[model samples]
Target: MSNEIINIIADRPFNEAVQDKYFERVEAQLTEVFARPRLRSFAKSGGVLAGRAAETIDASVVGPSLVVFEERLSEDDKQDALDSQAFAEAVVNKLPAETSQEQRYMAYNEALSAIGWVTESYTYKKYDSKKLTLTMNDALLQVLETVISAGSGNVLSLVAAGFDKLKGDKEALKIVDAGSKESSVVSFKAVPCIVAPGGGMAMVMGGLDVFSKDYDGDFLFFTFKTEGVHLFQAAGIRKFNKRAFDRKRQQVYNYIDQFGDGLFKKIAG
Candidate 1:
């Protein structure tokens, strides 16, 4: 899929004018998302939610398993995480002795409650590999049309030459907090040194940011977000149109999150 996109963008004019600009725009948003204060808080409290992977403490969330923080606990709340064994026993008593399954689940809930979980909203997430392939092909097809004119012929030497142009963007890179580079490639791009738009664009940027890092030496990747978009839009590349496509796709994912199983039935129908 990526190789095909690369071939289309490999047109010299498009490479010089189109590719780096898209990467720069995406990178900017990723940098912004990664830099949020809450991320630092998450790192500082890194010991949290690590051990709950196997437990289903609450049906408030419907995932097979995922541990997410609802909120932060106050100091007194932290201190009050007392005698979980005792609380677990109390939970065991509250259920019928024959209902071992219910008792065990309730005990887990007691443990979670002793911690600082103060909220109860959930967004269920799922991914379809086949759908993902279709989506990628569709996105790439549009990108090719944007770069290649109707009669523009035989400019083929596999033009989408990766992100070799990223070196230019790196010269101006304002890297901050050298020590905070995230081990996770995705999280690293959305770090605070960049910007976030709080929507699908931000997500696309984050994903691209991770991609650049993951394939750093393999491609000419860069991220610029708003700056690159504005520059390219003014120059007639319509990079923002690509962003709109990404945003619209993201909105569909979000809709599915809210609709959950009902949406899945419609999708599979």
Candidate 2:
């Protein structure tokens, strides 16, 4: 099934008919998955809170394709959703209409690589504040240590000063204390940092209270009332794109899982 779809997309002047067929195949697969009795029961019981289970499944299946689809949209068009046919057309529509075929091919390959990363490594989990503290502390310590090892003495001093301030700030202390006591709950999402060409991975920790200086890489942005953390890696920085956020956010309640401790250890060590 996958090979057939790949072959269809490999042709130059990408065929809309073939793309439609690909979407149909994906839709069919999702439909079957959602039809399972257990999933249906869960969905009916409000286990899937962000709209219907079908929509969640749709988003997860088509999410990767949007990486390619969105790159072609104009500012105005980006505000609207594109149908499968329209998306197919956009895939072949190189901006400026004069882009060389070689450049177009390179863009196509990059999109393919990005999509592969998401499909293969994206994950979701739910954790209590105690667990979250351990995870966040490890990640923060690693980042700080990395900077120190690089001999960025001035930056290290600045970051250490910031950390000291965070420890004293009443609001910051409240969150840290709450998380340390396991009184808070959190939803976590991790995916390959596709937006950043060389980034290892990006994480979003919903309900986790963190100071600005707590993170050292790229940048960290915040959102209010968001169901899950949305981190979109593009160019050299990570940003929030709610529309492309997790479709599996609701499933977090069903699982108690550890974040990428091994990955962190490997990088930190």
Candidate 3:
């Protein structure tokens, strides 16, 4: 059987949840300073960049504990997980009073809190008896997916670099095409763009998780652009700042930082 999965879209103005200007500034600076070297390294070494894995979830126990996984998920089996969360209740209650910008903010927060709650509570338990593996080509696709998911730099830069590498190598293309059959690909559709060298872009499908996790119990297929893939990271930070900062300068800084990290993490990851 397949492992269950849940999707969560976070609250807007995400930085506001942990409001600190200095934290914002430092984060931006770190991202900018690191981005170029990271991209160069990725290009030189191929696209298998490393990222600092987020604090690990204790998968060891969860991996084997079907009993525990079942018990934890019993309630979720019946309802839309967010519907039962306190955050969702609060957001719904606040909806009628959402007259001011601040109230709208609260509503947004409530929604995000609900999402986080569901994602954290939900678990994907991989049974040892149901083990799966990807071939080298499939493994490479998973690596591409991971780079896109955790990367902290510009989407265009990453996409451009990633593409350049892939296009230059027949081996990479073979891996990507074969891997796509075994897993859910980060589905990206083409979009028009004027800024990209090739005058086009691509968007990830099924959202970021397309790159964030393994798919089909075997391979993982990450999204990339033949041209405008770098925009993905930029777009993420831009979305965060659009709702987070009241100040325009702060918003701009956040965009740069967020975009930079997207690229940085990809190469570094």
Worst 10 residues of 2 by lDDT: 260-269
TM-score of 3: 0.22
TM-scores for candidates 1 onward, in order: 0.16, 0.20, 0.22
List, residue by residue over 136-219, the lDDT tens digit for candidate 2.
323333333321225434333433333344434444333223322321222111111112224233211111223223332211
Better of 2 and 3 by TM-score: 3
lDDT score for candidate 3 against the true structure: 0.26
Q: Pick the winner on lDDT between candidates 1 and 2.
A: 2
Candidate 3 per-residue lDDT, tens place, 17-128, comes to: 3445424543554466433333221111222322412321111000000000111222222111212122222232224432432333334333433232211111111212
Q: Candidate 2 versus the native: TM-score?
A: 0.20
For every candidate structure, what is the RMSD over all alpha carbons to the true structure, in angstroms? 24.2, 19.0, 19.8
Candidate 1: which stretches are off by over 4 Å? 1-148, 151-170, 173-213, 216-269
CA lDDT scores, all candidates in order: 0.21, 0.25, 0.26
Per-prediction count of colliding residue pairs? 24, 2, 23
Model 2 global lDDT (CA atoms, 0 to 1): 0.25
Model 1 TM-score on a 0 to 1 scale: 0.16
